[model samples]
Target chain A: MRYVTPRKAAVGLGASHTGTEHHWWMTVSSAALALLTPSFLMVMGTALQLPERADILLYFTRPYPAIVVAIFMTLGMMHFIKGSRIMIDDYLEHTARKVAIIGFSIFGWAVIAFTLFALARIQLAFAQAI
Target chain B: MADVNRGNRPLSPHLQVYQLPLAAITSIVNRAAGQAMVAGLLLLAFWLLGAAAGGGLWDWADWLTRSWFGFLVLLGSCWALWYHFLAGIRHFFYDAGEGLEIETARMTSIAIIAGSVILTLLSLIIYWI
Candidate 1:
């Protein structure tokens, strides 16, 4: 069985190598994020504030819901970075302006990377934390 | 215009070359965000699959994600989100008949970029702690 290389299978990135290398990851992330926003907004809007942080965590941790939340956080972070890249390019008119914009973008990626580490830990260690 | 100064400027097929309207720029940004969100979901799927498969498949993913490079890519996505989230809101605003003027639209665009950066940093502080 042969698996396709990135160059071969990234049809979404064809002709021009943009927004295609991470197609599956991006699509799934968007879908999950798309599902999560409304739910989180609802949960945040009505709650009378939990007494303990851990309790709040516990409330969100039950199986399917927890999974959804995790997906939400991950996709939210991912989309932000890719989205920013486009935005930066839009307003940065000068060459230096573009560089500065891109530099800020790199920082965005940095934040996501660190946040993911936290997410991975929280998701995998769900049983032990409680 | 940036092009007014140069005699023969080499144009690199770019989005900036287009006479972009607020609607057009907003659409482009939304698509970028939509695509990236999709990537994030895919990454989550890998994690979920790993969690499901038991064995050590998921653990391997966990390990990679925790690695230096994986962390970097993930962080990039985080930024993508903060920016897109705001940009998405801007679109919603536009949909509601706001930021229609050229100046107002551009200002809103700038605001979206600045606000997203600020928010992304805030999340990192919380996450890092």
Candidate 2:
């Protein structure tokens, strides 16, 4: 049989072998989001009270609001994908697990793509208006 | 073989048997909230797409969201979002090898539930003012 060195074993791959990596990525994104989420709420919350149409467009056209929302959407979706994976693994088995993971992953990436596209379109509109 | 004695062995604690601790319950609820927010994200996408489409689409989204039922859903989602966010932060601390003690876990569990509610109310207050 093949052998892993003490150093390799110490890395703690665990049964799934990807546990640590997934944990670290989720942790880092979670930390980033912990900071970003409050700001995200503030941005969206402010935009909510603005007068319809013109004021709302003017608000989102600014770099800060657009950029903040974009980053938060991206990071938050990434975290959601991983978090959903863990939950799927816990409660699902066999074919269901595979199907749920695929479904959730596609859903997450689709949101990311759609949000980015919308933000870019907004930015383009803002630029053309100037 | 290892399986020889396992045939008659009792199963481990599971949903029907074990009384879950506060921290375990918090973690489970956090997962549920995360899953629920997936639906919320779809609504958010609908709003963004409406914004991009313009020509009254944005107005429609805003009108629907401001309706009483829609507003209630939004409030519930807001609570879930904040709760999941804080729970994520707490998990980060645990991942880093900190706050593993029982007392710490219990306190953090309570903190997450309380903090999320407070943050949700605070945001609503800010939105209204």
iRMSD of all candidate structures? 10.4, 1.4
Write down the worst ten-residue block by lDDT for model 1 chain A. A44-53
Off by over 4 Å in 1: A1-67, A70-130, B1-27
lDDT of 2 at A112: 92
Q: Clashing residue pairs, candidate 2?
A: none
- Candidate 2, chain B, TM-score (2 decimals): 0.79
Encode model 1's per-residue lDDT on B69-126: one tens digit a residue: 6556555666666666677666556656987898898788778777867876775565
The 10-residue segment with the lowest total lDDT in model 1 chain B: B45-54
Per-residue CA lDDT of model 2 for A33-101, tens digit only, reads: 888887888887787677666677778888898888899889888999998888899899999999999
**DockQ for all models, in order?**
0.04, 0.53
How far is B48's C-alpha from truth in model 1 (Å)?
2.0
Task: Write one digit per residue (lDDT tens) for candidate 2, span B35-73.
Answer: 776665666666676677787877787677667866676
Tell how far residue A54 is off in model 1, in angstroms. 17
